[model samples]
Target: MEYDYHCTVCRGHLRIGNKLVFSAKTRDNKYGLIFLSPELGDYTTEHHPDFDIQEGEEYLFYCPICHARLNHTENEKLVRIFMVDEKGAEYEIFFSGIAGEKCTYRMRDKEKEELGPDSEKYRQYFDLPDEYRKYL
Candidate 1:
Protein backbone atom coordinates (compact mmCIF):
# COMPACT_ATOMS: atom_id res chain seq x y z
CA MET A 1 0.00 0.00 0.00
CA GLU A 2 1.15 3.50 -0.83
CA TYR A 3 1.51 6.17 1.82
CA ASP A 4 1.74 9.92 1.47
CA TYR A 5 4.49 11.87 3.19
CA HIS A 6 4.05 15.56 3.97
CA CYS A 7 6.04 18.38 5.40
CA THR A 8 5.21 19.02 9.04
CA VAL A 9 5.41 22.80 8.64
CA CYS A 10 3.97 23.58 5.25
CA ARG A 11 2.04 20.38 4.81
CA GLY A 12 3.43 20.08 1.30
CA HIS A 13 3.39 16.72 -0.42
CA LEU A 14 6.85 15.19 -0.10
CA ARG A 15 6.56 11.86 -1.90
CA ILE A 16 7.16 12.09 -5.62
CA GLY A 17 6.88 8.82 -7.44
CA ASN A 18 8.43 6.25 -5.06
CA LYS A 19 10.82 8.59 -3.23
CA LEU A 20 10.40 11.16 -0.54
CA VAL A 21 12.41 14.20 -1.59
CA PHE A 22 14.06 16.62 0.83
CA SER A 23 16.59 19.40 0.87
CA ALA A 24 19.64 18.40 2.86
CA LYS A 25 22.54 20.36 4.29
CA THR A 26 25.73 18.95 5.63
CA ARG A 27 27.63 20.25 8.64
CA ASP A 28 30.10 21.87 6.25
CA ASN A 29 27.27 23.82 4.60
CA LYS A 30 27.10 21.58 1.54
CA TYR A 31 23.61 21.40 0.13
CA GLY A 32 21.80 18.96 -2.12
CA LEU A 33 18.58 17.23 -2.85
CA ILE A 34 18.06 13.94 -1.04
CA PHE A 35 15.72 11.27 -2.31
CA LEU A 36 14.80 8.60 0.23
CA SER A 37 12.83 5.42 -0.08
CA PRO A 38 9.24 5.70 1.11
CA GLU A 39 9.36 2.36 2.82
CA LEU A 40 10.09 2.46 6.52
CA GLY A 41 13.40 0.79 7.51
CA ASP A 42 14.73 1.14 3.95
CA TYR A 43 17.96 3.10 4.02
CA THR A 44 18.31 3.54 0.28
CA THR A 45 19.11 7.12 -0.71
CA GLU A 46 20.05 9.03 -3.82
CA HIS A 47 21.91 12.30 -4.03
CA HIS A 48 24.34 14.20 -6.19
CA PRO A 49 27.84 12.82 -6.12
CA ASP A 50 29.26 16.18 -5.19
CA PHE A 51 27.06 16.32 -2.10
CA ASP A 52 28.71 13.64 -0.09
CA ILE A 53 26.98 12.47 3.08
CA GLN A 54 29.35 11.14 5.69
CA GLU A 55 28.30 8.14 7.70
CA GLY A 56 27.78 8.77 11.46
CA GLU A 57 27.57 12.51 10.76
CA GLU A 58 24.36 14.35 11.47
CA TYR A 59 22.82 16.33 8.63
CA LEU A 60 19.99 18.80 8.42
CA PHE A 61 16.85 18.08 6.44
CA TYR A 62 14.34 20.55 5.05
CA CYS A 63 11.09 20.48 3.22
CA PRO A 64 11.74 20.80 -0.49
CA ILE A 65 8.68 22.99 -0.89
CA CYS A 66 8.75 25.44 2.03
CA HIS A 67 12.36 25.11 3.09
CA ALA A 68 11.28 24.30 6.64
CA ARG A 69 13.86 22.43 8.65
CA LEU A 70 12.76 18.89 9.40
CA ASN A 71 14.72 18.41 12.62
CA HIS A 72 12.67 17.71 15.65
CA THR A 73 13.21 20.29 18.39
CA GLU A 74 13.13 17.59 21.04
CA ASN A 75 15.87 15.59 19.35
CA GLU A 76 18.20 17.18 16.86
CA LYS A 77 19.28 13.79 15.60
CA LEU A 78 15.76 12.98 14.52
CA VAL A 79 13.87 14.39 11.55
CA ARG A 80 10.12 14.67 11.63
CA ILE A 81 7.56 14.34 8.87
CA PHE A 82 3.89 13.60 8.58
CA MET A 83 2.43 10.56 6.90
CA VAL A 84 -1.01 9.46 5.79
CA ASP A 85 -1.80 5.95 4.72
CA GLU A 86 -4.21 4.98 1.96
CA LYS A 87 -6.93 4.61 4.55
CA GLY A 88 -6.28 8.21 5.74
CA ALA A 89 -4.71 7.25 9.05
CA GLU A 90 -2.26 9.94 10.07
CA TYR A 91 1.05 9.30 11.75
CA GLU A 92 4.09 11.23 12.84
CA ILE A 93 7.19 9.74 11.27
CA PHE A 94 10.61 10.24 12.74
CA PHE A 95 13.86 9.05 11.26
CA SER A 96 17.50 9.38 12.04
CA GLY A 97 19.28 12.38 10.54
CA ILE A 98 22.70 10.80 10.86
CA ALA A 99 23.86 9.24 7.64
CA GLY A 100 23.82 5.42 7.45
CA GLU A 101 21.85 5.11 10.68
CA LYS A 102 18.71 3.16 9.97
CA CYS A 103 16.06 4.29 12.41
CA THR A 104 12.47 5.16 11.73
CA TYR A 105 9.46 5.56 13.97
CA ARG A 106 5.75 5.62 13.24
CA MET A 107 3.60 7.18 15.97
CA ARG A 108 -0.09 7.86 16.34
CA ASP A 109 -1.68 8.89 19.58
CA LYS A 110 -0.40 6.44 22.18
CA GLU A 111 0.60 3.80 19.68
CA LYS A 112 4.20 3.73 18.55
CA GLU A 113 6.15 1.45 16.24
CA GLU A 114 9.86 1.30 15.63
CA LEU A 115 11.66 0.11 12.51
CA GLY A 116 15.20 -0.63 11.44
CA PRO A 117 18.12 -2.07 13.39
CA ASP A 118 19.34 1.21 14.82
CA SER A 119 15.94 2.14 16.10
CA GLU A 120 17.02 1.34 19.65
CA LYS A 121 19.43 4.25 19.56
CA TYR A 122 16.62 6.70 20.19
CA ARG A 123 13.75 4.43 21.04
CA GLN A 124 14.06 5.38 24.68
CA TYR A 125 13.41 9.01 23.89
CA PHE A 126 10.04 8.23 22.46
CA ASP A 127 9.21 5.70 25.10
CA LEU A 128 10.04 8.03 27.93
CA PRO A 129 7.36 9.71 29.96
CA ASP A 130 6.27 13.16 28.86
CA GLU A 131 8.02 14.72 31.82
CA TYR A 132 11.42 13.48 30.67
CA ARG A 133 11.05 13.94 26.91
CA LYS A 134 12.90 17.24 26.95
CA TYR A 135 16.06 15.57 28.15
CA LEU A 136 16.74 14.01 24.77
Candidate 2:
Protein backbone atom coordinates (compact mmCIF):
# COMPACT_ATOMS: atom_id res chain seq x y z
CA MET A 1 0.00 0.00 0.00
CA GLU A 2 1.02 3.63 -0.44
CA TYR A 3 2.12 5.78 2.51
CA ASP A 4 1.74 9.47 3.24
CA TYR A 5 4.07 11.74 5.22
CA HIS A 6 3.34 14.81 7.28
CA CYS A 7 5.10 17.23 9.58
CA THR A 8 4.60 15.91 13.10
CA VAL A 9 5.00 19.42 14.45
CA CYS A 10 2.64 21.37 12.20
CA ARG A 11 0.65 18.46 10.81
CA GLY A 12 1.39 20.01 7.44
CA HIS A 13 0.93 17.77 4.44
CA LEU A 14 4.42 16.72 3.36
CA ARG A 15 4.17 13.75 1.04
CA ILE A 16 1.07 12.78 -0.88
CA GLY A 17 1.96 11.47 -4.28
CA ASN A 18 4.42 14.19 -5.35
CA LYS A 19 2.53 16.92 -3.62
CA LEU A 20 5.07 17.83 -0.88
CA VAL A 21 8.58 16.81 0.06
CA PHE A 22 10.69 16.40 3.18
CA SER A 23 14.10 17.89 4.04
CA ALA A 24 17.19 15.91 4.93
CA LYS A 25 20.70 16.68 6.21
CA THR A 26 23.92 14.79 6.48
CA ARG A 27 26.42 14.93 9.31
CA ASP A 28 28.47 17.34 7.20
CA ASN A 29 25.44 19.68 6.94
CA LYS A 30 24.49 19.03 3.31
CA TYR A 31 20.76 19.10 2.55
CA GLY A 32 18.27 17.53 0.12
CA LEU A 33 14.79 16.07 -0.10
CA ILE A 34 13.78 12.45 -0.06
CA PHE A 35 11.08 14.23 -2.01
CA LEU A 36 10.44 17.94 -2.57
CA SER A 37 8.99 20.07 0.19
CA PRO A 38 7.20 22.00 -2.49
CA GLU A 39 7.29 22.36 -6.25
CA LEU A 40 8.25 26.04 -6.32
CA GLY A 41 11.78 26.00 -4.84
CA ASP A 42 14.90 24.04 -5.65
CA TYR A 43 16.63 22.89 -2.47
CA THR A 44 19.43 21.21 -4.39
CA THR A 45 20.91 24.43 -5.75
CA GLU A 46 24.55 25.28 -6.65
CA HIS A 47 25.10 26.75 -3.19
CA HIS A 48 23.94 23.45 -1.66
CA PRO A 49 24.68 19.91 -2.65
CA ASP A 50 23.34 16.51 -1.57
CA PHE A 51 25.02 14.80 1.37
CA ASP A 52 28.49 13.41 0.95
CA ILE A 53 28.85 10.22 2.89
CA GLN A 54 31.92 8.47 4.23
CA GLU A 55 32.54 5.36 6.26
CA GLY A 56 30.71 5.40 9.58
CA GLU A 57 28.61 8.55 9.25
CA GLU A 58 25.07 9.58 10.15
CA TYR A 59 22.37 11.45 8.21
CA LEU A 60 19.34 13.40 9.35
CA PHE A 61 15.88 14.30 8.04
CA TYR A 62 13.71 17.10 9.30
CA CYS A 63 10.63 19.13 8.60
CA PRO A 64 11.34 22.01 6.20
CA ILE A 65 8.37 23.94 7.52
CA CYS A 66 9.26 23.90 11.26
CA HIS A 67 12.94 23.17 10.77
CA ALA A 68 12.53 20.51 13.44
CA ARG A 69 14.93 17.58 13.34
CA LEU A 70 13.18 14.30 12.45
CA ASN A 71 15.98 11.73 12.55
CA HIS A 72 17.90 12.72 15.66
CA THR A 73 18.39 9.99 18.17
CA GLU A 74 20.96 8.15 20.25
CA ASN A 75 20.77 5.42 17.66
CA GLU A 76 22.33 7.13 14.64
CA LYS A 77 21.05 4.84 11.95
CA LEU A 78 17.29 4.92 12.30
CA VAL A 79 15.50 8.17 11.40
CA ARG A 80 11.78 8.36 12.02
CA ILE A 81 9.31 10.18 9.83
CA PHE A 82 5.63 10.57 10.64
CA MET A 83 3.63 8.61 8.14
CA VAL A 84 0.08 7.46 7.56
CA ASP A 85 -0.59 4.48 5.47
CA GLU A 86 -3.34 4.54 2.83
CA LYS A 87 -5.51 2.52 5.17
CA GLY A 88 -5.30 5.45 7.61
CA ALA A 89 -3.14 3.70 10.14
CA GLU A 90 -0.57 6.16 11.52
CA TYR A 91 2.98 4.95 11.71
CA GLU A 92 6.54 6.08 12.23
CA ILE A 93 8.55 5.35 9.13
CA PHE A 94 12.05 4.40 10.27
CA PHE A 95 14.43 5.15 7.44
CA SER A 96 17.95 3.87 8.00
CA GLY A 97 20.59 5.70 5.99
CA ILE A 98 23.66 3.90 4.77
CA ALA A 99 25.32 6.62 2.65
CA GLY A 100 24.53 9.71 0.58
CA GLU A 101 20.88 9.44 -0.42
CA LYS A 102 21.22 5.70 0.04
CA CYS A 103 19.03 4.26 2.76
CA THR A 104 16.34 1.73 3.48
CA TYR A 105 13.16 1.37 5.44
CA ARG A 106 14.25 -0.42 8.57
CA MET A 107 10.86 -0.51 10.25
CA ARG A 108 7.33 0.82 10.19
CA ASP A 109 5.85 1.19 13.66
CA LYS A 110 2.35 2.22 14.56
CA GLU A 111 3.92 3.14 17.85
CA LYS A 112 5.56 6.49 17.02
CA GLU A 113 8.98 7.56 18.09
CA GLU A 114 9.81 11.08 19.22
CA LEU A 115 9.97 13.14 16.04
CA GLY A 116 11.78 15.73 18.17
CA PRO A 117 14.14 14.44 20.79
CA ASP A 118 15.37 17.65 22.44
CA SER A 119 12.42 19.98 21.88
CA GLU A 120 9.49 17.69 21.23
CA LYS A 121 9.77 14.52 23.23
CA TYR A 122 7.92 11.68 21.56
CA ARG A 123 6.03 9.15 23.58
CA GLN A 124 9.07 6.95 23.21
CA TYR A 125 12.30 8.38 21.84
CA PHE A 126 14.22 6.13 19.45
CA ASP A 127 17.03 4.34 21.27
CA LEU A 128 17.58 1.25 19.21
CA PRO A 129 20.87 -0.57 18.74
CA ASP A 130 22.91 0.88 15.85
CA GLU A 131 23.30 -2.34 13.94
CA TYR A 132 21.55 -1.80 10.64
CA ARG A 133 22.25 -3.85 7.52
CA LYS A 134 23.92 -2.27 4.46
CA TYR A 135 20.58 -1.93 2.71
CA LEU A 136 17.17 -3.01 3.92
Candidate 3:
Protein backbone atom coordinates (compact mmCIF):
# COMPACT_ATOMS: atom_id res chain seq x y z
CA MET A 1 0.00 0.00 0.00
CA GLU A 2 1.58 3.20 -1.18
CA TYR A 3 0.88 6.18 1.01
CA ASP A 4 0.72 9.81 0.02
CA TYR A 5 2.08 11.58 3.04
CA HIS A 6 4.54 14.09 4.44
CA CYS A 7 7.07 13.91 7.22
CA THR A 8 5.74 15.00 10.60
CA VAL A 9 9.15 16.21 11.73
CA CYS A 10 10.55 17.81 8.55
CA ARG A 11 7.28 18.39 6.68
CA GLY A 12 8.74 16.75 3.61
CA HIS A 13 6.65 14.83 1.09
CA LEU A 14 6.56 11.14 2.00
CA ARG A 15 5.90 8.30 -0.39
CA ILE A 16 5.76 4.96 1.34
CA GLY A 17 5.17 1.54 -0.07
CA ASN A 18 3.53 -1.54 1.46
CA LYS A 19 3.64 -2.05 5.19
CA LEU A 20 6.50 -4.42 5.95
CA VAL A 21 6.97 -6.01 9.38
CA PHE A 22 10.33 -6.02 11.12
CA SER A 23 10.30 -7.71 14.50
CA ALA A 24 12.78 -7.62 17.39
CA LYS A 25 12.84 -7.87 21.16
CA THR A 26 12.92 -4.56 22.97
CA ARG A 27 15.13 -3.68 25.92
CA ASP A 28 12.17 -4.33 28.18
CA ASN A 29 11.75 -7.88 26.89
CA LYS A 30 8.70 -7.02 24.80
CA TYR A 31 8.10 -7.73 21.16
CA GLY A 32 8.57 -4.70 18.93
CA LEU A 33 7.44 -3.95 15.43
CA ILE A 34 9.24 -1.84 12.88
CA PHE A 35 7.95 -0.81 9.47
CA LEU A 36 10.40 -0.92 6.59
CA SER A 37 10.67 -1.51 2.89
CA PRO A 38 9.50 -4.92 1.77
CA GLU A 39 12.39 -5.08 -0.61
CA LEU A 40 14.65 -4.97 2.42
CA GLY A 41 14.09 -8.74 2.56
CA ASP A 42 16.17 -10.22 5.38
CA TYR A 43 18.79 -7.50 5.29
CA THR A 44 17.95 -6.21 8.80
CA THR A 45 18.57 -9.65 10.30
CA GLU A 46 22.25 -9.39 9.47
CA HIS A 47 24.45 -9.54 12.55
CA HIS A 48 25.76 -6.18 13.67
CA PRO A 49 27.30 -5.14 17.00
CA ASP A 50 25.85 -1.66 17.29
CA PHE A 51 22.20 -2.61 17.65
CA ASP A 52 21.17 -3.76 21.12
CA ILE A 53 17.55 -4.54 21.96
CA GLN A 54 15.64 -6.69 24.46
CA GLU A 55 12.70 -8.78 23.44
CA GLY A 56 9.14 -7.39 23.96
CA GLU A 57 9.58 -3.65 24.44
CA GLU A 58 9.11 -0.39 22.64
CA TYR A 59 11.75 1.28 20.48
CA LEU A 60 12.02 3.95 17.85
CA PHE A 61 11.89 3.33 14.18
CA TYR A 62 13.73 6.27 12.65
CA CYS A 63 11.83 8.46 10.25
CA PRO A 64 13.36 8.64 6.80
CA ILE A 65 12.52 12.32 6.48
CA CYS A 66 13.44 13.99 9.76
CA HIS A 67 15.41 11.09 11.18
CA ALA A 68 13.29 11.40 14.31
CA ARG A 69 11.80 8.39 16.02
CA LEU A 70 8.26 7.32 15.24
CA ASN A 71 5.63 6.32 17.77
CA HIS A 72 4.56 2.68 18.15
CA THR A 73 1.20 1.25 19.15
CA GLU A 74 -0.50 -2.11 19.38
CA ASN A 75 -3.08 -2.39 16.65
CA GLU A 76 -5.37 -5.43 16.53
CA LYS A 77 -2.78 -7.68 18.21
CA LEU A 78 -0.04 -6.54 15.87
CA VAL A 79 2.51 -3.94 16.86
CA ARG A 80 2.10 -0.95 14.61
CA ILE A 81 4.38 2.01 14.11
CA PHE A 82 2.77 5.31 13.22
CA MET A 83 4.29 8.34 11.52
CA VAL A 84 3.00 11.49 9.91
CA ASP A 85 4.81 13.16 7.08
CA GLU A 86 5.09 16.89 6.26
CA LYS A 87 1.72 16.82 4.56
CA GLY A 88 -0.12 15.72 7.65
CA ALA A 89 -0.64 12.27 6.27
CA GLU A 90 -0.53 9.37 8.70
CA TYR A 91 1.00 6.01 7.95
CA GLU A 92 0.88 2.82 9.99
CA ILE A 93 2.62 -0.53 9.65
CA PHE A 94 2.62 -3.79 11.63
CA PHE A 95 5.21 -6.36 12.70
CA SER A 96 6.03 -9.09 15.22
CA GLY A 97 9.15 -10.76 16.69
CA ILE A 98 7.95 -14.30 16.20
CA ALA A 99 8.96 -15.65 12.86
CA GLY A 100 6.62 -17.33 10.40
CA GLU A 101 7.16 -20.90 9.30
CA LYS A 102 8.59 -19.79 5.98
CA CYS A 103 11.26 -17.64 7.61
CA THR A 104 14.78 -18.43 6.41
CA TYR A 105 17.66 -19.78 8.49
CA ARG A 106 19.90 -16.86 7.61
CA MET A 107 17.32 -14.44 9.01
CA ARG A 108 16.75 -16.54 12.11
CA ASP A 109 20.46 -16.97 12.84
CA LYS A 110 21.11 -13.31 12.33
CA GLU A 111 18.35 -12.41 14.77
CA LYS A 112 19.64 -14.93 17.29
CA GLU A 113 23.20 -13.70 17.10
CA GLU A 114 22.12 -10.12 17.53
CA LEU A 115 19.94 -10.98 20.49
CA GLY A 116 22.74 -12.91 22.14
CA PRO A 117 24.95 -10.41 23.90
CA ASP A 118 27.58 -13.12 24.24
CA SER A 119 27.88 -13.17 20.48
CA GLU A 120 30.97 -11.33 19.29
CA LYS A 121 28.85 -9.30 16.87
CA TYR A 122 26.27 -8.24 19.47
CA ARG A 123 27.65 -4.77 20.03
CA GLN A 124 27.91 -4.07 16.35
CA TYR A 125 24.44 -5.47 15.69
CA PHE A 126 22.87 -3.07 18.15
CA ASP A 127 24.01 -0.03 16.20
CA LEU A 128 21.66 -0.68 13.31
CA PRO A 129 18.22 0.90 12.97
CA ASP A 130 15.34 -0.66 14.90
CA GLU A 131 13.91 -2.12 11.74
CA TYR A 132 17.23 -3.78 11.04
CA ARG A 133 18.59 -4.13 14.55
CA LYS A 134 18.54 -7.43 16.47
CA TYR A 135 17.34 -7.93 20.03
CA LEU A 136 18.56 -10.18 22.81
Off by over 4 Å in 1: none
Instruction: TM-score each candidate.
Output: 0.97, 0.52, 0.28
What are the per-residue Cα lDDT tens digits for candidate 3 across 15-121?
Answer: 43554333344445544444444431232433134445444334544455565443333211233344444465554433333222112111221342221222232
Off by over 4 Å in 3: 1-47, 72-91, 94-136
C-alpha positional error of residue 134 in candidate 2 after TM-score superposition, expressed in Å: 21
Tens digits of per-residue lDDT for model 2 on 52-90?
A: 444445657678788777664544565556667668877
**How well is each residue in 54-100 modelled by candidate 1, as lDDT tens digits?**
99989999999999999998888999999999999999999999999
lDDT of 3 at 48: 31
**Alpha carbon lDDT at 33, candidate 3:** 44
* lDDT, each prediction: 0.94, 0.50, 0.37
1 against 3, candidate with superior TM-score:
1
Per-residue error (Å), model 3, residue 106:
27
- All candidates in order of TM-score, best leading: 1, 2, 3
TM-score of predicted model 3? 0.28
